[model samples]
Target: MRDLTSTEEFHELAANSPVVFMFTAGWCPDCRVIDPIMPEVESTFSDYTFVSVNRDAFIDLCIEKDIYGIPSFLAYANGSESGRLVSKDRKTQEEIEAFLSNLSK
Candidate 1:
């Protein structure tokens, strides 16, 4: 997964490709829990570009996207949102896979 650098980069990538912005924080335990499974998830969903957004580094972006949780996922394609799994809950690998799988519907 790629680390998000700036708001501009976020928008640019989202507008251009199928991008999944994963909102997370270094101090968040739930975020750490998902870290181990991310590589597998990313590999499975190879069509989407995974970008890790640090909550602390992009608080304004999180607020704008209505993301009030760590380790949330926001998927975008063709300059618009395609799907999202935004919540304060701990997400399982199954749940994450389900979310991504259902995006096209």
Candidate 2:
């Protein structure tokens, strides 16, 4: 997965391919809860541009997106958002699978 540090970097990722953008923080417990599981998701969706943006380091970018929480996932395709998942609870693999399947269609 790639780490996007700027708004322009995120925009580039969004325009390049199907992107799964994750907004997270170093001290967020929720983010830590799902950190290990993320690599599995990344492996499953090799075709996607998996991008992680640290909320603290990129506060301006997060504000522009109106991000309301840590561990928010946004999917982009065709230069626009196609889906989103945001929460503290660890999302099930089935949920992730279903979301990706729906977006890929």
Candidate 3:
């Protein structure tokens, strides 16, 4: 996944492609669990945009968006919020795929 390190990059990405920006902290167990499997998401949605945001690096944005939990997925289409899939319990491959596939249309 591409690293979205700055607000400019985040906005640019969200505005450009059918992107999914994941808000996760490095220390979060749920994030660690999902990290390795993200390659599958990247491959599956090769035509769509996929990005990652480090919560520690961008806390203000996270709070502004109310990203209270790790593994929160902010799915955007042309810079708008299309959907969200969040929480430790819901961060699964199938869940992610389902959300991405449904919105990809």
Candidate 4:
């Protein structure tokens, strides 16, 4: 997954393709847990572009997007939000896969 450096970059990417923004932080254990598994997830969901957004670096953006949770997942298409897997609870690979699966429906 590519790291989103700026909000403008995120918008540009989202405007063109199906995007899944992964909101995470370096200190988040849950985020770390998913890191190793993300390669496979990305491969599985090849249709979607996955981008990583560090919550600490983009706190204001996170707030603007109402992403209050670490390791949150938000999907977009044509620059519009399609679905989200945002929560304070820990996320599992199954849940992440399910979230992506449901987005297609």
After superposing all C-alphas onto the true structure, candidate 3 shows an RMSD in angstroms of 1.5
lDDT string for model 1 (1-105, tens) is 999999999999988999999999989999999999999999999999999999999999999999998789999988899999999899999999999999862
Q: Candidate 3's residue-wise lDDT over 21-63, tens digit each?
A: 8988778888898888899888988877788899999998888
lDDT for each residue of candidate 2 in 1-105, tens digit (9 for 90 to 100): 778867887888787778998888889887887778878888888778788889888888777877778778889888888888766556666777677777851
lDDT of 4 by residue, 37-104 (tens): 99999999999999999999999899999999989998988668889999878888999999999885
Q: lDDT for each of the candidates?
A: 0.93, 0.80, 0.83, 0.91
Which RMSD values do the candidates have, in order?
1.0, 1.8, 1.5, 1.2
Off by over 4 Å in 4: none
Error of 4 at 41 (Å): 0.6
Most accurate candidate by TM-score: 1
lDDT of 2 at 30: 72
The 10 consecutive residues of candidate 4 with the worst lDDT sum are: 96-105
Scored by lDDT, the top model is 1
Worst 10 residues of 2 by lDDT: 86-95
Q: What are the clashing pairs of model 3?
A: none
Task: Looking at model 3, report the run of 10 residues with the lowest lDDT sum.
Answer: 84-93
The per-residue C-alpha lDDT of model 4 at residue 54 equals 94
TM-score winner between candidates 1 and 4: 1
